[model samples]
Target: MPPPNERDPLLEISGLRTHFSTREGTVKAVDGASLTVPRATTVCVVGESGCGKSVTARSVLGLIDHPGKIVAGEIRWHRTDREPLDLAALSPTGPELRSIRGREIAMVFQEPMASLSPMYTVGDQLMEAIRLHKEVTKDEARSMALDLLRRVGIPRPEQRFGAYSFQLSGGMCQRIMIAIALACDPALLIADEPTTALDVTTQARIIDLLRDIQAETGMSMLFITHDLGVVAEIADEVVVMYLGTVVERGGVDEIFHDAKHPYTKALLGSIPRMGAGTRQRLTTIRGNVPHPSDRPSGCPFHPRCGDAVPGLCDVEEPPEVVFGPARSARCVLHAMERSVR
Candidate 1:
C-alpha cells in the first residue's frame, strides 16, 4: 500500500455517524462521512437535501440536538496555537466546545430572517455575538459590528446597524447573517446554503463577497449547497454526498470534468449546459433518495445508479477507492477499475 501523503488540514471528519432516535426507528443522518477542509480553502459539500450535508455541518459544531447524537467518528480540529482536538469525543454541552463555537468556528444558517431575531436591533445582535467571544466593551463591539456590516457589502452601515431584521430585504438580511458569523473572525466558517433563497444576481454578489473575504482573512470555509453551479464558482475542493456518505471528493476541476462515481456523474449531468439547444432538457438522476428509516441493504445509491451491477451493488456496500492524495469515491465501479489494475 502507498504511504499516506501529508495533509494541510484544518478540520478533518472521519467515519462520522450521527444518528437520530425516533418513535419508529433510528435515522442515520450522517454515516461514515469523511472530508478534509484544508487551510484557507473552500470545501463545498454538494448533495440533495437529505443527503446529510447539513447534518454533517451541524455535527462539526456539536449542534445535533437530543434524540440525535454522534454515535461514532472523530472530528479532528487542528489549531495552529494548540494541539489537535477530537470534537466528537468532547461533551456537546461542555464549556470547552461552547467557547470554541463562536470564537473559532462560526456558522451562517440558511434562513436569514429566522436566524436573526425580530426583537433586537441588528447592531445589538452583532455586538452581543462579538462581546460573547471577545472582551471588548459595548462601544468597541458596536464599532466592530459596523466594520463587519460594511465588509459584508451592506449599504450605509451606520443606518442599517440600528434597523431591525424585518426592515431589511432578504438579501440584506442574509448579508447580516454573514456579518454575524464573521464577528469573531472565526478560523472556520460553516455556511449552510446561504444563497438558497436569494435571487440569481444577489447570489452572485454574495458568492463574490465570500471569495474576497476568504482571500483577505485566510480563513477556511465549509460551504453547504445543493447547487452545482455555486460549487463551480466557489469550491477549491468538492465533496459529493449521497444518502449519508461521501460518494466522491476531489478538486473542483477533477469533479466537474473527470468524475469518478456514477452518482457524481449523474449530478454533473443534471447541470444545465449553456449553448445547447433551447429545448434541450437537463439530465436528472432517476429515483428518489431512499428514506432513512427504510435504508437500502447495500450501496445507498445503487437503486438510482444507472450503472449499478444488480447482484453486487445491491448486495454489498463498496469501500471508498482512493484515487489520489485527497480524492476518492464510494462506488463499486471504481472498485472494479482498481481491481482490473
Candidate 2:
C-alpha cells in the first residue's frame, strides 16, 4: 500500500450507529458517532467501559453479530488509487469484506487469550494469518511469522512460536497478537485495548512497540482505550465518547489542555496525576455510565455534568459545535462558553 498522505481521511465513520436488539429494548452501543482517521495518524477513542469504544472498532471490521447490527451510518474506507469503499454497505460476511479485513485492515482485540485459539500454537496461528492474506508458501509464511514475532520483541520467538496462548504470559500473548495483526502489513490497525490486561511495564513496552511499528509502517490506527495516560502517549488526535456518542474530538494537546465537553473534562480530571495529594481522593465523574438500553435523552452525560443547563441539556440534544478547523464538540455549553470568550 502507498504510504498514507494528508490529502484525505483514511477512514471516515459518519453518523454510524451500532445497536443490539434485545428482548427488553434496543441497546444503542454506538449512537450516531462520527470521526475521521487521518492517514498515518493515531486516533484514540476513549471513554468509560460500555461507552461503545469496542463496538465502534468491531463495527469497522464488520464483526458485530447476533441481534446487534450497524443500524445506520457509513464507514468509508478510502483508497489511494480507487474509489472509497463503503464498508457499511458491504456484506458483513462476504468474500470481498473478508479480503479487505485481514489484508487491508487488521485488529488486535482486548483479550489476547480469548482472541487466540488454545488449540493452535502461536506459530501456527501467525503463519495462518500471513498465508490467509498473502500468496505465500508454508515456508515463506513461517519465515514471515517468525520475523513478525521478532519485530514485536518476543524474546526467543522461535521458542515461543510453538507455545499455545495458555502457555504464555499475558504480555507475551499480547505481543503475539500484535505480531499477528501486523503480519499482513495492513494499511489500518484497530487496537482495542491491546494493553489492558498487562502490567504497567508491559503496557509501556506495548505502547512503545506500537509507536515504533507505526513510525516504520506509516499505518493509520484507531486505538480504543479508557486510559488517558495511554491516549496522551500515543494519540495524534483524540475522540472522547460518552454513552455511545462522540462528545469531543481534537488534537491530543487540545483535548488534554482545553477540553470543552463536560464529560471530557470530568474524564480528564479523573485521571490520576503524579504528585496529586496522597490523602486526597482522586476526582471521579459522579455517576456511572448509563446502560445502553437505558440511555438518557438529550445530552447523555447531563445527569452528571456540573455545567449542564437543566432545561437545555436535559431536554434537547446538542448540535456539534465547530471550534476551529480541527476541533469540535457535541455540547451546547461549548457554543455559549465560546461566545463569551
Candidate 3:
C-alpha cells in the first residue's frame, strides 16, 4: 500500500484568478491567490468579507455558479487515494468533479440555513451525501447518519433524524452541515466560517469538534474566517488576504507576532487586548475593502496603507518577498530590503 499523504500538501492553489462577469466588466474575486493546505494540518484563510477567501475555496471544488467562473490558474489536489489532479480544469458539474466533491473534498458552508433545504429532513440530507459516495443499503446509511449526528453533538440522533432543518436551532443546523461534510470522511475539508452564526459557546464547540475530527481522521482543512481569535486558535498556517489577493502568509505565530504586510499588521492591531479597558477602542483599518470594480492601480491596498510611499507604492505593485520557505509578504515595504540584497 502507498504511504499516507500526510507528508505532502493536500491542496495547492497557485495564481488562481476566479472572476465574475458583470454588465459593467469582469470582477476579479480571487486574483493571484496562492496558498497550500498541507495534509493533516489546518490552513486558515483570514480576511474581511469580499477579500475572496470564499471564492478561492469555491474554485477549489469547482462550485462557482453561473456568471462566476475560474478564469485562470491551477488548483492541484494531491489526493491520498489517487494520483494528483488539477481541479481547476475539471468541469463543474461533470461526473469526475462530482465524484471528488464530497468523497475526497467536503465543505461546510458559511450559512447553515442557506445551505440546508426545508423540503428534506436533515437525516435524509446527511444520508444522501453518504449514500452518494458509498454503496450502502438504506439501513446502513441511516445508521451511519445517526452515528454522525451523535459525533457532531446532535442530541437524540434518532429523534432529530426526521426533523426538518427549520426545526433545528442555528447551531444544531451547523452541526448537521458538519455531519454531512464528514459523512464521506473526506481527505480535505473546506470550512467557510462554519461558526459565524453561532453564539460564543457554540462557536468554541464547533472549533473543538473540527480539531478533534481532524486529529482523528488526519484530514487537511482550509478554514476561512475574519476572526483573528479563531485563526489563532485553529490555524497551523495563516493566509492573510486583502482585496482579491493574498498579501501575506506564514505560520500562525509568525502571522500574529511578526506580520510583514501592512494589511496584516492592521488586522492584528484590531484584535482587542486582554488587559485593555473595555471602553478603549480597537485599532481599525482606514478604509473598507475596495469594490471589485474599483480596484486601485499599483497596490490595491495602497489607498489605506499607512506605509505607502508617495510614488513607489501607488505607481508599481510590489513583488512577493520570500523571507523563508514558509513566510512571504506582498508589500512595497520589502522592496528596499530586496534591492539592498
Candidate 4:
C-alpha cells in the first residue's frame, strides 16, 4: 500500500457519472464512481459484464460518444510538469483534451481489430500515433514504432511492422495495441479487458508484458476486467463493482484476505480451483445482474446477496465504511454496525 503522505495523485476520479440515452430509457452506465490512481500504481476494476467497468475507463479518456455524456463529477489529471486539469469539463473536440488523450493517457480496447484500421499497415498505424503526439519526422516515427513493437515483445518487429491486423494472431494484435498505446510514453494507460479473447497462454504472456512495461516505464494503469484471477495477478488495488456502483475497494491483500462485502466474498468463492477430491459444482450468485433501468432499490446487490439484511440493505443506500486507511466497502453490514456503535 502507498503511504498517505504521498502528495501527488496521477489521476483522481470523484462522483463520476456517465449516462446514455435510449428510446426505451436512460442507462446510468457509470453511476457516481470514485477512484484514485497513485503515480506508478496499478488499480484494477473488476465486475460482471455490463457493470460499467469499461464505461468508467472510457469516461476517463473523455471518449464517450453521442447519446452518452459525463453527467457529473471531476477527473483531475496531475501531470509531472503541468498544472492539474479537470478532464470531465474538457470539451471533447477541443485541442486541449485531444493533446492529452494519446500523449498523456492512452487506452487499449478489448478488440484490437475494432480499434485498429484494417486499411492501414501496422507500421503506418504505430507511426501515425507516434508522429501525431510528438514532433518527429516520418523516418524517426517509423524507427520509434519498430522499437515500441520490439519493446512489447513482438519478434522480428521490423518484419511484423509491415503486416496488417488480420495477418497477426489475437495475441500479436493485442501486443501491437499495447505498442501503440505506449508510443507516446503515456503517464497513465487504461486497458479494458486487454486479454479477454486470447488463449490462456497468450493471456499470461500479455499480463507479463504489461508488468514488465509498467516497471520499466513507471506508468500507472487502470486495468478493467471481470476475472478475479487477472486482478490477483496484476492489481495493487482492487475495486469491486455491482450494477454500476463500487461495492468495495481495497489493496490486494485486504480485498483477497479480508473481503468485507458479501458480493466480493461470493465472487472469490466462485473461482474454480484445482485438485479437489470431487468435482464440486462451482457456486454462483443467485440472480443475474439487474439491467440499468431496473436496478434494485437501495443497495444494487441486495437481491443477490446471500447475507443481506432485510430492512437496512433493501431500504437505504449504504455509506462507505472505512476499514483501514486505504480500505473501504459500501455495504449495510459495515455501515449499520458502525452506526449502532
Residue-level lDDT tens digits of model 3 in 108-140:
999999999999999999989999999999999
Candidate 3 vs candidate 4, TM-score winner: 3
lDDT scores of the candidates, listed in order: 0.91, 0.91, 0.91, 0.90
Residues 112-202, candidate 1: write the lDDT tens digits. Answer: 9999999999999999999999999989999999999999999999999999999999999999999999988998999999999999999
- Candidate 3 has its poorest 10 consecutive residues by lDDT at 1-10
- Judged by TM-score, which candidate is best? 3
Q: What is residue 270's positional error in candidate 3, in angstroms?
A: 0.9
TM-score of 4: 0.96
Q: Write the per-residue lDDT of candidate 2 for residues 1-341, one digit (tens) a residue.
A: 66546746999999999999999989999999999999999999999999999999999989998999998999999987888999999889899899998789999999999999999999999999998888999999989999999999999988998999999999999999999999889889999999989999999999999999999998999999999999999999999998889999999999999988888888888766778777656668887999999988888998998888978998889889998866899988776676799
Candidate 1 weakest lDDT stretch, 10 residues: 1-10
Taking every candidate in turn, the Cα RMSD to the unseen true structure, in Å, is 2.9, 1.8, 1.3, 2.3
Q: TM-score per candidate, in order?
A: 0.97, 0.96, 0.97, 0.96
lDDT of 3: 0.91
